[model samples]
Target: GIKGAFRTRIAYVVQTNGGQFPYELRVSDYDGYNQFVVHRSPQPLMSPAWSPDGSKLAYVTFESGRSALVIQTLANGAVRQVASFPRHNGAPAFSPDGS
Candidate 1:
């Protein structure tokens, strides 16, 4: 037998430094509590997407004059560099198989 527990969670993307130039990724509770930064970059970071299970996040970062895709796990706070393009790589979406 399996019992499904109900929980409330909220996810958002925040831009650091007031979105001046270099932006960042942030997530928090539904009531705007427990706010935390998920990803940050001195150059710029944008377009954050959550995994199907909500256990990980995928985002793009521009730090080396190019954009790169990075996936971060919410459990242990581990990040994995997935892809990087020469010009720009933005907006990452996770597949059904968690890829």
Candidate 2:
């Protein structure tokens, strides 16, 4: 069976220059190949976090015109916004049990 860190990919973010108007969150192999986008928005994205089992990602995005936390499931391209309030939301992390 696959074991250790190499068995899973890594997560990162890529930002374009001024006026590009959007940013992207990416996932790629640890060796820096097979890169692909996990999220994109015209506002901003920050605090990207990967699930303990590498099956999902939790991050902050300004897609709604305010900071909001979003969780994306890699297996089927499912996304759901969460932890949003009237002001700001960010710094998302998964519990040890992947809850």
Best candidate according to lDDT: 2
Model 2 weakest 10-residue run by lDDT: 1-10
Q: The CA-based lDDT of model 1 is what? A: 0.72
Instruction: Record all residue pairs in model 1 with backbone atoms less than 3 Å apart, i.e. clashing.
Output: none
Q: What overall lDDT goes with each candidate model?
A: 0.72, 0.82
Q: Write model 2 residue lDDT over 24-50, tens digit each, in one string.
A: 898999888999988776888898888
Those runs of model 1 whose alpha carbons end farther than 4 Å from true positions after fitting are: 1-7, 18-22
Clashes of each: 0, 0
Q: Which ten residues in a row have the lowest lDDT in candidate 1?
A: 1-10
Model 1 residue 82 CA deviation in Å: 0.8
* Model 2 ranges with Cα > 4 A deviation: 1-8, 18-21
